[model samples]
Target: MSQYGAKYKYGKASPSDGFDCSGLIFWAYGKHGITVPRHTAAQSKAGKWVAARNARQGDIVVFRIGRRLHTGLVADKGRFLHAPSSGGYVRMESLSGVYWKNKIVGYRRIV
Candidate 1:
């Protein structure tokens, strides 16, 4: 939540520099001494997969919009937080929304 409204910075992770999708996830987990990959490709495969309907808060939410992979942290049953895109900011998005629902790859729990 601290990162909410932080502008997106491709490939960067810290709050000062802003964050890309997976970078947010990387830094967040690392903050608690839990190591997670810093890129979507690796991140999508690092943990055991879980069905989205059963995903709990803090689960890694994975999505593949066409060939571009995006990752974020689940904030609730149907909402997640992430740095959405190039000009976007970190924000909570609904998993059940049409924009995201079709793109969802699944969910993963790393800790």
Candidate 2:
């Protein structure tokens, strides 16, 4: 994850270039030979649902932002790594932050 910090690009999945939200997830999992769907909606349903209280590192966190879905990789109990937006790069952020907390839908464990 350190290799990807501050690197972001819309609709790109390459680490050498950058990544979007789901693309980041796709790249990280692919590094471990785990394959996941490319879209956030499909990704939200790809793994078994885990209650937020049980979330651990590597768990996929899903969020509902207006009519679209967003995703992040849980880095710890209270933080996650994500490629925030067009102008933002991949970064670690607090899940408990008011903005993220209110948008969270659930967490999924792929492994």
Candidate 3:
């Protein structure tokens, strides 16, 4: 897993860099030599769907919010890495957080 706050620091990208939630996932995994789709729906379809109970490091987590789907990378424990629209930077967030807990659709493991 990346350093605790590595998600908040954009090494692969830039702090002022513009990236939506999926953009962060696509870029981070790419830095690690993993090629992922550019969008949440497509990314979700790219990996093998896994049960949340079996999720591990580097897994792709999918969320269903309203009519839109969101995607992020698993960090560790119950934390996940994502570029939130409000935050405007990639950061580690809790899976059990109300925002995510409510939207969690499923998880996908590409590696």
Candidate 4:
């Protein structure tokens, strides 16, 4: 939660520096001693796949943007937390938006 509003820095995964999409996942889980893969693709396959309806809070949410993948942690009903892109800040975004809704790949639970 502390990362909210932090600057987005590609290839970083810490509150002091900033975070990218998957970087937030890496740091958030690491704070609890969980070892999650450090990149979007690997992290997307890091845990048991769960249907969207069954996906609980904290599940890894994956979405395909063009040929690349993006990731974030599931938030409220239709939102997810992430550091969107360079120059963007960490924040919660609606998953139901036309762009995001169309890009969803799946959800995964690390625990």
Candidate 5:
């Protein structure tokens, strides 16, 4: 399953009900029987960044979307799994899309 699908995509009032970005990662990892940190910033500090040229499935893609860090899971062909924002649902977004291209901070791989 795509990691984003396991959790709400956007417009969530709480972490449990809906996922922002990192929440999606946390939920997805939990589904695979692994546990990850909850907050985006904290999560960013947890993994080691890998070059996009070497990115693989399940690797974390971090973005500086605004004041906070936004994150997604690497999908095939330069795509990423993520929860976009309010009203957005879990989806696979292109890594080259304007939103992602402009804000991408780094990529990290955990396990």
Candidate 6:
């Protein structure tokens, strides 16, 4: 997913081009033949809920940024991969960071 960084677009989900937060997740799971929703709100309810402390790789990390929802895929126990804002790139970030910790709403297991 590193190849998708820096050039991310807000609504497109193409790996050769760019992606939004939910679009990135949708594309990643689609490559594995798993179908998921196209919006963060729908995606948030697509999988079973899991506690953040028990989150594992592949779990969906949901966050509430002001009045908007954001999502990322768990990369490990304490990190997640996501396509950030329109000007940001797809990157792995630590969940323990103050910014994420305070924004995190919950975790979900898509599989």
Best candidate, lDDT? 4
TM-score against truth, every candidate: 0.96, 0.95, 0.80, 0.97, 0.83, 0.93
The 10 consecutive residues of candidate 5 with the worst lDDT sum are: 6-15
Expressed as tens digits, the lDDT of each residue in 15-89 for candidate 1 is 989999999999989988999988999999988998877899889988998879999999987899999999999
Look at candidate 1 and tell me the lDDT of residue 8: 99
**Per-residue lDDT over 67-110 for candidate 2, one digit per residue giving the tens place of the 0 to 100 score:** 99999999987999999899788999999898999999999999
Residue 104's lDDT within candidate 1 is: 88
TM-score of 3: 0.80
lDDT tens readout by residue for model 4, 1-111:
678899999999998999999999999999999999999999989999999899778999999999999999998779989999988999988989877998999999999
Q: Tell me how candidate 3 scores on lDDT.
A: 0.75
Q: In candidate 3, where is summed lDDT lowest over 10 consecutive residues? A: 3-12
List lDDT for all candidates, in order: 0.91, 0.91, 0.75, 0.93, 0.77, 0.87
Candidate 6 lDDT tens digits, 54-80: 899888899999999999999887989
**Regarding lDDT, does 2 or 3 come out ahead?**
2
| lDDT at 87, model 3 | 40
Q: After the best TM-score superposition of candidate 6, give how far the Cα of residue 105 lies from its true spot, in angstroms.
A: 0.6
Compare candidates 2 and 5 on TM-score and give the better one: 2
- List candidate 5 segments past 4 Å from native: 2-16
Screening candidate 1 with a backbone cut-off below 3 angstroms (N, C-alpha, C), the clashing residue pairs are none
User: Which residue pairs come into collision in candidate 2?
Assistant: none
